[model samples]
Target: MSTSHDAALLKPGFTDAVFEAQAGFRALLDALAYAGRITTLEVSLDPPAPLDPATAAIALTLFDFDTKVWLDAPAAAGPVPAWIRFHCGSPIVSETHDAQFALVADARHLPGLGDFDIGEDRHPDRSSTLVIQVPALTGGSATRWTGPGINGSIEVAIAALPEGFWAQWDDNHALYPQGVDVLFVCGRQVIGLPRGVKVEV
Candidate 1:
């Protein structure tokens, strides 16, 4: 009764899950600390289809038994969810609001920032973190970012995001310590956008 999808779900994760996840975790930390700066993930992984290597690596690195994840339609119905379940032991939730992390494989259909969890004033760390996959990490329309991590401002490019992304970000930024943070993945590169950062298109 097993299908090809089931078989794919059984595939091994990173070649060295612990070490690879550790390295990826460090890279992600640096990306977030620097805000708009692009950080490359040099982890070896054989991720399931529809889940890019960078995205997959991040899931493995960040999620644990205590975390809950929400995957987009394409990723949820595929082997990617099962792969994460097997490797990361993170529960996959049906509601975006319940997720600690939301994996958006297609940027075009990304959910509005308000739809996800924006932690309450008493516990701001409860907010969801978005891991969005994009076409390219660089060479698109420029967006100027400024806030805690930058000296003055930094211009970065991210290709193929949903329309009104910046408008939504404006609202998200206004939430201050309660807003969700984002990590954009393209190929092996990742760029972070923390809640405190301001983005001008």
Candidate 2:
């Protein structure tokens, strides 16, 4: 009893489920392991527009039936969420705070970082993870980043993020292990912003 639109929602997923998902997970670890360093997610996926292939790959690798995902307005309008539910079997939640993963198809419409769950002290791993689609990873205003994964400090520029994002990031970073983690994706590239990373705008 599936409509044409519903059928279309089920897009092609990872080319090789096991191997590709592992590669995507490794790429995610590498990105977070080297703060501000751009990592490539090379998995093959044909998700609907506005959902970057890299972001989709990460979704496939990260989400499970037990996970709850929140999609921004623009993302929710598309096939991306349905595709995630189809492949990953994760529940899509209406409330941001209820989500373990939130996907933003348009970075400009992103909600406040604090709107999502930051996790409790006893369960820091319960925090949300944001996968945001940005214009580009470079050619934006440069800011100094320093944290555990960074060698010392690095100059990072991610374009088209909403104004005052870094300021909110400062607040989020203060929460340490309880804060939400982020992966900013554009095309096949992703930049990780772990909760430990500090930004000087």
Candidate 3:
């Protein structure tokens, strides 16, 4: 646990915490409800190093005492973890499998989707949700997506992910009702890719 003085050294959470969190939560819901579609998040907060505004906002909105978070190397160091502990009150875990939500600062070096909790057949909703920070939301290799939330087919692009990201995602998609979901964040934008969604590069 971080002391109050340690937390005070980090950047604060949203200015209008309650309202901002509510608005951010709505944006997150909208993103997930329309998988593969990018949604804009507007939350006023200066998060610590390694945490983008969108990721930080999502953390504040979705995480609570009930959730366990896993922070990647960069995010685990410095004041970022302390800030999350102070604002979200979610326990930060060391193992990826132990996390309900995982935050990765760099998508290019992100671990395989299979590394996280995929949940059981009867409780697929308990699977881990990964928040990955990408360079940009658009202008990269395009991938086609089709799933429940998507009406038909939609093309989406994310910049600078590792080489085998799509391959790993393909394997994850094959898991159907038992795989981790993903949220790609860049700047103040966020896009969802639920476990059921199929992606074709």
Task: Please provide, for model 1 over 46-84, each residue's C-alpha lDDT reduced to its tens digit, 9 standing for 90 to 100.
Answer: 678788889988988899999999999888888777788
Query: How many clashing pairs does model 3 include?
Result: 0
**Could you tell me which 10 consecutive residues in candidate 1 have the lowest summed lDDT?**
1-10
CA lDDT of each prediction against the hidden true structure: 0.90, 0.90, 0.90
Ranking by TM-score: 3, 2, 1
Candidate 3 lDDT over residue span 67-186, tens digit each: 999988888876777888888889999999999999999886588899999999999889999999998989989999999899999999888988999999999999989999999999
Instruction: List runs of model 3 lying over 4 Å from the truth.
Output: none
Runs of candidate 1 with Cα error greater than 4 angstroms are: 1-9
Separate clash counts for every candidate: 0, 0, 0
RMSD of 3: 1.1
Write the residue-wise lDDT of candidate 2 on 63-171 in tens digits: 9999999999988997777787778889999999999999998999899999999999999989999999998999999999999888889999999999989999999
TM-score of 2: 0.95
